[model samples]
Target: MKIPSIVFALLFTSFSYSQNISGKAYYESKTTVDMDNFGRRDMTEDMKKQIKERMKSFLEKTYILTFNGNESIYSEDEKLEAGDNGRGFGMMMSSFSAGDQYKNLETNQLIEEREFFGKQFLVKDTITNLRWEVGKESKQIGQYLVIKATAYKQVDPNDVSMMRRRRDRDNEEKNEAEKKEDTTKVEDPFEDLEIPKEVLVTAWFTPQIPVKNGPGEYAGLPGLILELNVDRTTILCSKIIINPKEAEAIQPPSKGEEVSREEYNKIVKEKTDEMRENFRNGGGRRGGGGRRFGG
Candidate 1:
């Protein structure tokens, strides 16, 4: 008995749809700390470890993307936990795409445009406040197309309390005659306060996928972003599932502060500087103890 041409075509389509490709995304990124204008401070072994851990945390945070004619969903899960207790901080981000059941529920949503990295680009209105910028180049990730993008991290220079600490120290140096007897030190409440300059990042995206989205505040690519690099850290797409055997179910996250990509960078820089200050002042326990303990 011969099958009808329509029936054969249906079977072929089903077979093609059933095929699921899986693989791991390997990323090698360089990280540098701007210590002085002369050059960048190389990342120490401990610093590298910390960066990897941070990337692991970022991946643990979820971001979503959608494509046209695809009812499927894509996501990544960071397999690492918080803290520095061994277990190696690593991540595995995956994507799922398939039938209408798996399609994005908000595909009709409008794409919003904002200025990022000195360029006009598109992003989702839900996350319009986040800063984004264009990158300098492009590359391929598996079968998907990818382009590079950049974003800035800003720093706030007006943290008054930190400045007060500096004034307290200056007052200690004044001679008795130079210092007014009745005058209380009016501390300049902005010393010791540092704001990080805007940092540039490069990311890889594929415009054909039709989603201007990525992890953290980085977005506004012509296509779905597959990989990104900011400063020295990186985030990459590991696996994608288009048309899973099971029903596709994806729930986009609504938690997290919505800041422009620039604002986001500023926050990170401020916190990082604060932490480094704490470490330098011997206020917090240093990681690895700088080789004193054979770390």
Candidate 2:
């Protein structure tokens, strides 16, 4: 008679979790600005430095997570009243920003508001619950004990959307041409272009929180997620406010063109392609795009 490895591991991690835990979790999210990824080859050294400065305002950001039981709303805490983190030029910088996301584990639903080219989209779809491989290893995050979990997420390898990176005008025009396919044939509305996907996600959750929720699209753990590391971006929880005096109403975003995730992605692709066309033909400065939220 012998105890299996999995059973022993589970028994070792069976710490007494907390009870009646509910509250707000403050997470600080930071992203790196990859200059080469922005597709600016002809940019001078001075120009590159300037672009980094402007993008810095967005790369380092703060987000708030409000959760009670298995429901949560994750959104950016832009400190709008403070005004662009005192970066006066942020108002004139880029026009598009990511939207807030809300998820409900009880209903298996998700409602996210994504902003693209100044247009808002209500992305209504069921939550993509990732299959996580839990490990026996454990570590202490603050007062709670957390175990490791790993998952793989399919992502566009050439996706420059994160942090709203720049795309070259010529490349976009070339892509559009490729869509035309046969030169002698009529243009095709769609192309069979295949996008590569590559991304690995690592998350650590604390059983003490005891909720299957986390920041952004991450959830489905036996506990609360305290840290999420995806690619070059890091979203870490800095503080947990349990049972706040007042809780904000947790509701899905109602405004914007109601559409599914796939539909919204299509809309974004079309709008972005059009923007590149204008830029290639020297249509002047872009007019659309603004902060995701304004205080």
Candidate 3:
């Protein structure tokens, strides 16, 4: 006997939703900085305000984390980008963060596709083994029960993002070399020369979500991370969906030139250092430009 078309459709729908418990989580992230640390001694208050307002996109962002039980992909959501036709001179900016990341918890491996200055890099490396100390504190985020966890993370002071941001904000007229000698306080707020860098990370994970995942390189938890705060940035999971009608295949990104994290770091440093040398010699600095991506 042949099955009815309606019955077949119902069975297919049930199978699709029940096959794997995949989910898409929406997160809202924001960053805050103290501009006074940059030695803006001569700037008027109005100038500072204008600069801050224009930097909202960099300070605030939206990201999406799609995951299943064993694998996940996290990426920034597309937004209306402010074009450069009218940004004026010296306003060019480039993103230091690269590539959509794919992670496999079973093997402790990660594939991140990174792009810098029209160059593509597929970064293959091990996921950071975060040592999370779970606390007895508990709270409620929406409908999920969350528990607090603390971690002391050692930050890489020479990361490309730090240099790029400082370069972007540095004034061409100022002598950075001379200013570096003043050790009392940070003469260049935009520069990242301070040592002993570390961040105290506080994370909230929900046991209901049963996935060892979080936003942007944070994981190895018993449950899904709902909220994370580190230094000036905060990533908070605003929405969650479990086992929807459509099953998403969390595939690893494989479209860039392969390289390791150490290699990529070296590449970024050389490029940045070259740009700085050119600027000092009056050949005009490479502005890193804005949002360069090469497949």
| TM-score of every candidate | 0.39, 0.71, 0.77
What are the per-residue Cα lDDT tens digits for candidate 1 across 1-295?
A: 2223433343454443323321222333233332221111344667655554554543334333332332223333333344443311121111101111122323523222322222233333333223555444556689865655555544335321111112123434343334356344332212333334544566666544444444444445444557876544566666554433553344333333334434543543454445445444543344523222111
- Which candidate has the highest TM-score of all? 3
- Clashes per candidate, residues 3 or more apart or on different chains: 27, 2, 2
* Cα RMSD (angstroms) for every candidate in the order listed: 15.5, 8.1, 10.3
Show model 2 residue runs off by greater than 4 Å: 1-20, 35-49, 79-93, 156-160, 163-196, 283-295
Candidate 3's C-alpha runs over 4 A off are 1-20, 80-82, 85-97, 162-196, 286-295
Give the Cα lDDT of each candidate. Answer: 0.39, 0.67, 0.69
Give lDDT: candidate 1, residue 128.
Answer: 29
Which runs in model 1 stand beyond 4 Å of their true positions? 1-136, 151-195, 245-247, 252-295
By TM-score, how accurate is candidate 2?
0.71
Which 10-residue span in candidate 1 carries the lowest summed lDDT? Answer: 91-100
By summed lDDT, which 10 consecutive residues of candidate 2 come out lowest? 186-195
Give candidate 3's whole-model lDDT. Answer: 0.69
Tens-digit per-residue lDDT, 147-235, candidate 3: 88888887665564533223244553455545556533322222443323667889888756767788988898767899999876889
